[model samples]
Structure formats: C-alpha cells, structure tokens
Target: MNLLSKFATVGGATLVSRIFGFVREMLMASALGIGPVADAFNLAFRFPNLFRRFFAEGAMNSAFVPLFSKALEEKGEAAARDFATQVFSFLTVVLFALTVPAIIFMPFLVRTVIAPGLNVCIDEAALQQALSCEDRFGITVAFSRIMFPYLASMSLVAMVGGILNAYRRFFAAAAAPALLNVVLIGVLVWALWDGQDTRALGFAMSWGVLVAGVAQFVMVTVAMRMAGFSVALRRPRWTPDLKRLLVLAGPAALIGGITQINLFVGQAIASFKPGAVSILTYADRPYQLPLGMVGVAIGVVLLPELSRALKGGRLDEAQHTQNRSLEFALFLTLPAAVALFIIPEPIIRIIYERGAFTPSTTAAVAAVLGIYALGLPAFVMIRVFTPGYFAREDTRRPMMVTMASAGANTVLSVALFYVMAEQGIALATSLAGWLNALLLFHGLYSRNLWIVDRSLVKRCCLLLLCAALMGGVLLLLMPLLSHWIQPGAGIGVQVLAIGILVAAAVASYFALCFVTGAADRQMISRMLAARRKRGARNA
Candidate 1:
C-alpha cells in the first residue's frame, strides 16, 4: 500500500476510537460532572494511563519498532520473532514488578504524585478540602489500585502491537484502543440505567479499564498469531539483544512519553483546585480527537517505514517519507487546530453540557481547549519529527530535548496555574510542545538528517493561510447558528449544528487547498493509478 493509504488504515481506525471516546467522556460528564467523583476517577485513570504511555506507546514503540524492523529486514522473520519473544518475556517480568508495587503504594502515589494538592488546598477558602478531599483521596487510591493492572496489559499490547506494526499490520493494534472506549461506554450505560451513584460508577469504570486492557492485549496477540508471528513465553535472558533494547528504551521513555509527562505535570498542578483536574481532562478530550487521528497515525506508520528505509540505505525514500508525513500532519491538523480554537464552546456544550456538566463548566473547558488548539500542530510535529531521530537510532538527543521540554512545562505550569488557573496550564503545555517540536526539527536539520524541502515549505505556507481563512469563515458562521448551538438548545439541534459547522469548515478548507494548489492533485492521481494497476495485476 501507499504511504497515505497506510496512514488512512491506522488513522481511520483511530477516528472510530476517538468517536467512541467522545461518547464515553460525555457519559462521564453527565454522570459525574466536575465533582469529587469525577476528579477522583479522572486522577485514578490518569495514573495507570501515564505509565501505559511511558512504557507501551512511548518506550516500547520507540525502542522496539526500529530494532524489530532491522531484524526483519536483515536477519529475517525467525530472528525477529525470537527477538520479540525475548523482549516480551522481559517486559512481562518488568510490568509485574511495576504493577505490584504501584498497587501496594497506591495511597502514597495518590496523595503525592497523583494529586498532591488534595492534601493541602492552596486556596484560602479551602473549598477543595471542604469538598471532602479525604474521601476523594481515598477513592482515587482505591480506583487506582483496581486499574493498575491495566498498565501491564497495555504494555504487553504495545509489545505485540509493535510487532504487528513492524509487519505492516496496523489495523489490529490501531483498532484495539476502541475497545477501551467501548467497554467504558458499556459500563456508563449500565450505571446510568441502574441509577448508580458517582462513587459506584467510579469503581465500575475502574474495573472496566482493567477488563478493556485484557481485551486489547488479547486482540493484538491474536492478530500476531494470525500474522504467523507467535511470541511464546520464554525464560527472560540478559542477552546482548535484551541489553541493547534496554539501553535504547531507557532514554526513549522520556522522548516517547513527552505528552503524557506534560499532562501529568499539568494534572499535578491543576489538582490544587477542586474540579480543576476534571475540567482539564474534559477540555483535553476534544483536541485529542485530531491529535490521535493525525499525530498518532503518523508516528506509528513513520517509525517502521523510516526504520526499514534507513536500514536498507534508502536515503531518498526516507527523506521523502518524512516530508510527506509532516505535510500530511499539517494538512489535517492546521484546520482542526483552527476550528477548535474558534468553536470549542459549541463543541464542548454539545458533548458535555447535559447532566451535572453546567454552562459554566462548559465555558471553563472551552477556554482550555482553545489554548490547547494553539499548540496542536506543535504536538503533531513532535510526533512527525521524532521518528527521524529514532529511525536513525539516536534517542539520547531527543530524550534530552524531551527532558528540557518537561522542565519548561513544569516550571511554566507551576507559575501559570497560580495565575491563570487551568487555562494557564493549557498554555504552558502548548508552549512546551512548541519548544519540543522546534528543537526536534532543528536537530534534524542541523545534523543533515532532514532538510526542509521547498515543496513542504510552500505547502505549509498555503495550508496555514487556508486554515486562517477557514477560521474566519467559522467566526462568521457561528453567530448565525448561535440559536441552535447556544446552551439551551435541544440536544438534537445542537448535534445538527455542530455537524453543519464541521461540514462547512471541512468543505471550505479542502476547497481552499485545491484552489491554492496546496494539495497536489497529480500526486494523488498517481497514487490512485498505482492502486488500480496493482488491482489489475492481482486479477
């Protein structure tokens, strides 16, 4: 398949997952609102999710894919399978070690790292403490313990998914995440049906997370077996291969998990205020749809593609891949960033303003989502550029850059959250994301690893203008549709309004792309022609 086709396979699946996630979040907002239960549940889930990113998506994908790709390209599938098995065994042992300790130390983690602000309300009113902080704290700890096993399951999923991705089997792993949202939505539906309280719902969802993790792990493992690559259990050995994987994975942990690290930092700081964590979490979901579809698809596809190209000494192909990936990222993301920045309120209101989620809460979440939109491209660029470094087996530099970005985010979040509240934290995360993206881009350029091609520069400029023009159109359109999108509108009307707004925005942006010659029609025709030729040959 072509590059864009491969991207679509992953991205399309991610789009499905994000749509389900939106439903899940809406249910949570309706059921729990931004109250203690919401705060506790969000914090509890974020803890394991933080580690899942650190281990599974971040370290495992970054460190494992290239090595697996190399082994497949050079040493053949048997050797690659053997290598995967070794890593699997090691990862199993490590996750067991990590989960057992984390569950045992759940309370301490909740009080200190998960939500330190719970212990001492910085606000003079002590509103946070008055809101049964001790009870919320205990709930967070218990919920965290119930869900901690998810980390192990997802980490293993990553290992298996990495193997599938290396074999260019992207669908299974990409679709696996949808199960988490599916499972959670089922739990929410059941809870809502049974009229369960927020506390009961929280516990149910925590267990749902564990169940979803196991489901995801099983799905990917089954896919691997079907792909003729079964990774059997083996004695964990400290061979050179295992040692090498460790060396590469260590620094990569930071590089891969930069977004999660920033979010963790923001969550920690946002914890000082009651409902702030939930507010930020709610705000975070809207922008994540675009990020997951564009940024994640590029990251997953680019790493293996670039690794194989580099391993086979295909420099031009590798360079072209990076350029196209960046171009593709901006093409989708720029418009999304602009639309979200322009119309977050309607989106948030339609999605979350049903039950305990009030108009005021919608406003709060919208503001944060707007600021996050500003950094959306930077966040995706980090995903696009990091592969350039990892494909070449240079993780330390990106790791250093990641650490610096995290430090900036921490310092900025701490300083800003005090002043601007949740919006300040959002701004800090965006600023830090830009810093991370720029450094990665510069590193690639300065080292002669990647050069900014003229086509990319031209298309990016055009896409930016296109996005701005689309934003202007949205600015003009929203007021006319305000009646339907306003807080008191019927849910069906609100949904229809958003659908109309998105359709118009997307229509205008792509129309502008073709009009401005930003989108290469000839290249698209060639891809189509290539696919037709392949189909004919198979026939």
Candidate 2:
C-alpha cells in the first residue's frame, strides 16, 4: 500500500470511529455536561483504556510482533500459529480472572484511584452562573463498576490485534475499533432520547463500552477465523516466547506508555473538582485525534515492517523506515498540535458547545486542551520512537527509560497538581513527555542505534516550515469557519465549516510541501495516483 493509502486504511477507519466518538461525546455533553456523571463516566472509561494501552496496545505489540514475526519467518506459519494460539488462550484465562475482581471492586477502584476531592461544589452561585447544574458524585462508584469488564475484553482485542499485525492483517484490525464507537453512539443516542440526568448518560455510555469491547473482540476473532488462523486452546506455557514478552513489556507498560498514565494523573488530580474529570476527558479527545492517527498509526504499521526488515538482515532498510516514519509523524502531527494550541476556543465550541455545556465550561475545557496540546507532538513521538527498541526485542532498555520517566511524571504530577490545578497536571505530563523522549534518544545515541539522516533532517526542517505556512492559513480561516458554524447552526453547516477548514489546511500544507520539496508530498502524490489507478482497475 502507498503511504496515504496505508494512512487512509488505518486513519480512515479511525476517523470514522472518532467522528462517531464525537457524536457520542456530543450526546454525552448535551446529557451530562461536564459534571459528576461526566466525571464518573470519564474516570470509569479511563481505567480500562489506561490498562488497555499499557498491557494490550503498545506493550503487547512492542513485545509480541517482533518475536512472532521471527517465528513466522524461521519456522513458518504453523509455528507462528501455535505460538499465537497459546498466547491467546492464556491471555483469555488471565484477563477474565483479573476482570472478575475488577468488576467486583469497581467501587473501591473509584475511591482509590480518584483521590478524594472537594466532594461537593460548595459554590452554588458558581453553579447557577455557569448553568442550573447539580453535583452528582454518587454515579462514579456504580457506573465505574458497570464498565470495568471492558478492560478484560479490550485487552484480549489488543492481543488479537497484535496477532493480526504479525500476519499483516491490518484492515480488520484497524476497523475493529470503529465498532466500539458505533456502540457508544447507539447507547448515547438512546440515552439522549430518554433525558439529561447524569446516571442516565453515565450508565448508557459505560455499558456501551462494555458491550462494544465484547463486540470488538468477537469481530477480530471472526476475522481471524475467516483468514484461516484458527486459534486453539493451549495451557499458559510461560515459554521462552512468553518469558521474553513479559520481560520486554513490563516497564513499557509504565514509562514508555506514560501518556496513558497521564490520564490517571489528570483524573486523580481532577477528582478534587466535582466536574474536573469530565473536563479533562472532553479536552483530551482532540489531543487523542492526532496522537492516535499519527503516532499510533506509525507505531502499529512500522513495527511489523521493521520486525520483518531487521529479521531478514535488512538493517539499513529498518533504520530508513524508522526515520521515514518519524518524518511522517512530525509532518502530520505538528499542525494538529499548533491548531489546538492556537484556537482551542473555536475547536471546543465547534465540537462540544451545546445545550447544557456553556461558554464558561468551554473556556475551562479549552484551557486544558491548550495545555494538553503542548504535549501533542511529543505524545505522538512516543509511539513512533518506542517501537525502535521493541522491534529489536530489546525491551529492558525501554523499561528502564519508562520507569525513570514514570517516576518523573508521578512526582511532577503530584507536586504540580497542588500547584497548578488541571493545567498543572497537563503541564506535568508535557514535561514528562519531553523527558521520556530525551531519555529514549539518549539511549539510542549511547548505543549508536539510529540517528536522523541528513536528508531526513533537511526534510524535517521543511515539514516545520510547511506546517507554519498551514498554521497561517488556519489562523486566517478558523474564525470565519467558526462563525459560519455557530451553536445554533445546523449539522450541515457545521460539517461544511469543518470540511472547508480541513480541506484548506491540508491543501495549503501540500502546496507548501511542493514549494519546499518536502519528503511526504512525493510519497503522498504517489499514493493518490496509486489510489486512482486502483479505482480505475476495480471499475
């Protein structure tokens, strides 16, 4: 697949999921509006996603795919099949056993993880001025309980996804997450029809995640079966393979995946404010858009490619892929980070401003969005860089880096939470992100692993310039777009506004790239030309 085609396959599906996720969050905002219910659901949703990223997404992929690919290369499909089946069977048993307790103790988890905050909003005038909203802290315990099992299923889905990646089964694996978004949209729409009570929305959304997690797991498994990858039960072997997986993945689960940890850090600190968790949650979505598309995409696609290349004794190609992917990340994500920082108000107002969520809340959430935006590029890079060490099956170095970064993040978050409020929490995360990146690069340099090539560095400078030129277009266009898509604006108008802005920004960037001879333009053009040819041939 061409680069844009590959991006489209993964990012296109992700964009669908994110759009539906937007609808889900909109229904949630209309119904819950950043209060106790929103807080409860956000925290509840966060717990599972946190571990999902750690154990399943980054950590698992980092460890498993390289090894699995090696087995696939050396021993053929049967050996890889046996290994995948053993991992899956053992994974299912362990996840279920762990999830059972988590579901049972969901209340305790909420209490422990979300540190006791100002349990009640003492400022009634503040509430009345913002909107006629009441504090609803009780939902946090019950709704969180309803949603914890999602972790178990999603963890498995991650493993299944990892197996699929090893097999180069990218499409189904990429599309799997859209199901979760679809389910949440259904449940949230149902809840919207019902009413705007905190419990009504919280319960619907939480239950949606649980249901969606199960559905996704089933979908991927079916896809696997259809591909003739029959998964059979095997005892947990803790074999050399499993041993290597654990050894490599454990620390990455913490330090390298510290971005996930940042969510909990923000939540723990936000618990003090009645609606703080929800605000953090709402703000996070925008940041996640770029992070997932650019960072997560490169990480997932490149790991397998890198694994195969390195395994086949193609070290130069492996390093080239790594540099090229990082170049891709910077090119795509920089402007997202810039737009988020520059115009948080319009972005928040456009996506979420509605009936119950007011201007003040938008401003508050926007502030956090700006803070989080500062870390956006760094966050995307984490996914890009960490795979370098992981694909080599050298997980321990990353672990050491991860633990050190986690310690720094934790200490910074705890200290900064008291000093700066929600923004402080985000700032701490931003600091920790740069710290983690520094350490990763330091290790790579110390060992003389991979360095940015001259051509790539030249391309990097041009990418920044192109992004700057695009930002100028955005700064000029955003206000016009926002005004055209005001709160009372219909969905058609809103869609048009977003379409124009996005198209304009993308076009401007490509024009700048062509002018500057940036790296991605030729790759992107080749991708578009290939797509056109594919379309023609299919017709």
TM-score of every candidate relative to the true structure: 0.96, 0.92
User: Which of the numbered candidates is closest to the native, going by highest lDDT?
Assistant: 1
Model 2 lDDT on a 0 to 1 scale: 0.76
Q: Taking the tens digit of each residue's C-alpha lDDT, what string does model 2 give over 178-293? A: 89888888887776676645556667777788899899989989988877787787777778877776776676566445788877877877777656777888888888887877
Model 1 Cα lDDT, one tens digit per residue, 157-176: 99899999999999999999
User: Cα RMSDs of all predictions?
Assistant: 2.1, 3.0
| Backbone clashes in model 1, listed as residue pairs | none
Task: List clashing residue pairs in candidate 2.
Answer: 117-272, 255-402
Give the alpha-carbon lDDT of every model. 0.90, 0.76
